[model samples]
Target: MRDNGAIAVFGATGQQGGAVVDALLARRARVRALVRTPESDRAQALAARGVELAAVRIDDPASTVAALEAVDAFYFMTPEADNLEEVEEEVRVGAALVDAAAAARVPHVVFNSVFGADRFTGVPHHDSKHRIEEHLKKSGLRATMVRPAAFMENFATVMAPSLEDGTIVVRMPLPDDVPLKMVSIKDIGRVAAALLLGTADVPGGAVEVVGDEPTGPRIAAAFGAHAGLPSRYEALPLSVLRNDLDEAMFRQFAESSESPADLAAVKAVEPDVLDLAGWIRSTGWTAPADRARS
Candidate 1:
């Protein structure tokens, strides 16, 4: 934001981080992307875009400090992993990154958190980030927290497979009248960049990002309209998602997917936020012809 020096970005190879890196580059900001493998294709691609790739392990304090050297600011987001050990690694690495940033005396830090991380939602993932936010607040670093709602990308990863049979099965019955808060990953990047660049009114304040709140039928209608298939929604109880998601997350989906973000404020920051239908049409998502093959 200050345009003083280069900014270091963690997880630059992943979705959220990549979007931030791209946005920063668009603003002509000097960016250094932290990654484990500098030779990886994604990392190399970032390097090709004029980003300085710093090959460093986040858990190692010394490596992290080196990565932050001469960095004027930082952008951080915790990485999610699959198993218990990997999950512990995420916390460890995230804490180490925070400590390293503090020790380096970086002037500004923008932290990516979940929309409902302000308090305990009984969801482990959501609550875990709240803890991280607390640590960041006390780390003596000037930080801005950017909390984003449920990602629209989940349509492809979590729901599209079920659509192969021309029927999408939802774990929780999302009534047509109910609303669910959803945001595009690109919009998340835009908001974060705005905060870091000091373009928004509340630069250091907590900002919740959400694009739209649509019901199950509305979502199915959007997908069906684009895919040209007779797709329908079949909502079950929250119990069906237990095996795949944490129990806490299941409760949120079954009860309320509507986020507590201020839509007007978020829209003010990123005016062109995409809605469900626009996002679906842009991705060219289609119905699968055969469920077995899909």
Candidate 2:
């Protein structure tokens, strides 16, 4: 462990938190993962990696504060809420965590927020995180917002392509040529780790992190090239999601080409940051043929 002290991270078993822990480990920082279920398999997995696990419940400030005691820094991110009701719950949970960090007197906090969260884009989930950002700001604790753009990993999940008639088709509720700002989950962790470790200089104590801006066709081509298959892009209607919150979010996505995250600026901090093609290759993302078989 480095002499700076242990860094405590909330949501440590999840994707964002897991990535943060990995980055901190790579930098030789001692990591304390605050989890609700210390007995969970995920928690055990982290513990196996030498991560110190502390049980915490967001509703119990005492538990959270105890988990944060003596940590050099705290890093956290809220779970996504798909409805207005869940959004309010997210705000409540986020505020509680922020309050706990303050009570513990952690010197610095790094919040993994979403890009455009500060803009009040009318997306319930994004706005919910912005509310947490507000709570963090008012808590009077030194804090930094490492706002990551859309996850490049989403292409492997929500935006994964479909195979039909021997061709791979990528679909989104977006125009084919409209670029979507993206950052790898790993990069998000790297940026947050830098802030928590005081290794990165971010103007205004916040940065919108993005590594690539790729349109649907470009996304399809990358997958196609990897698999040696033909590819195409399909623009789907927002109504297909059947969720008002998602529809509203996608509507804002239509304007994502104008995101504040500068690729050059992000790369300046994380030189090994991957673009779409690089992510595909590094992740070993294959075409739909392999996906379907899996």
Candidate 3:
């Protein structure tokens, strides 16, 4: 079991933060979840599972500072934004939280940044996180950044494959051979928990949390094999997305293959991190036929 002091988490009700809380609890670490509504169902469930609840609003950093005061480490991620305007608001909120953490004198921090955020990809949300990263660097507080790769969960939603002409097809604004680094939500948590508890450290004080590096064809093949069906990947044009932010993100997906993830580095921290095939199997990701049956 990993040894960790008390931890306070912002965005605890969301995907990344919630995963961190789960990983911390699995390690028997004390967790305080900062939520805007203590009485919400999700917060109540977390509370029932032994997570301490602290009410906080991003507009009021004082509430964050108060919740953070007694914690040994703090984990936080900015809220997801839909467009450039919301992206600006994300920067503001992140800056405020960084200032709050400084004021509270939190010993350590773990920022849930995106993979390639350090690069000026010009994707609005990615740039937003990088701006926060810049603020954290200037804050003078010790911080470890866990940069998450493409969420494996996306396949269950927007990235889901379609059955056309009796063939399963996964289409994305990516070329067939360009590699994409992917990670399960659980591994993101495990990696962050390791950093927060001092059980693991990255040489640069930042690590891109990644597991599998699969090309588009490989991704489709993995799903196909898992579902016992033949599948193919169709490379779609960026214009098909019709959203500037998403188009930029997919463009980066192609560009980033030049510098792929170091899988060994992540495995050193969390040995059981799932590969793409394993993740597909673990999710029991269904083909179109199976979903129709359900």
Residues 180-241 of candidate 3 have per-residue lDDT tens digits of: 88999989999999998878989888898899989889888888788778889999888998
Across 137-251, the per-residue lDDT of candidate 1 in tens digits comes to 9898988888887889988787563555556433334555666788889888888877777677453468877888777777777777776665566665556553433545656
TM-scores for every candidate against the unseen true structure: 0.88, 0.95, 0.95
Ranking by lDDT: 3, 2, 1
Compared with the true structure, all predictions reach lDDT values of 0.76, 0.87, 0.88
lDDT of 3 at 206: 88
In candidate 2, where is summed lDDT lowest over 10 consecutive residues? 285-294
Clashes of 2: 0
Pairs that collide, model 2: none
Distance (Å) between predicted and true CA of 229, model 3?
1.3
The residue-by-residue lDDT of candidate 2 on 1-294, one tens digit each, is 235689999888999999999999999889999999999999999999999999988877899999998889999999878788999998998899999999989889888888888768888999998989988999999889988888998889888887767788899988887888888999999988888888886778788888888888998888888878888999887878968998987788777675445777677678888888898899987666544454
The predicted structure with the larger lDDT, 1 or 2, is 2
> What's the count of clashing pairs in each model shown?
0, 0, 0
Question: Candidate 3 lDDT (Cα, whole model)?
Answer: 0.88
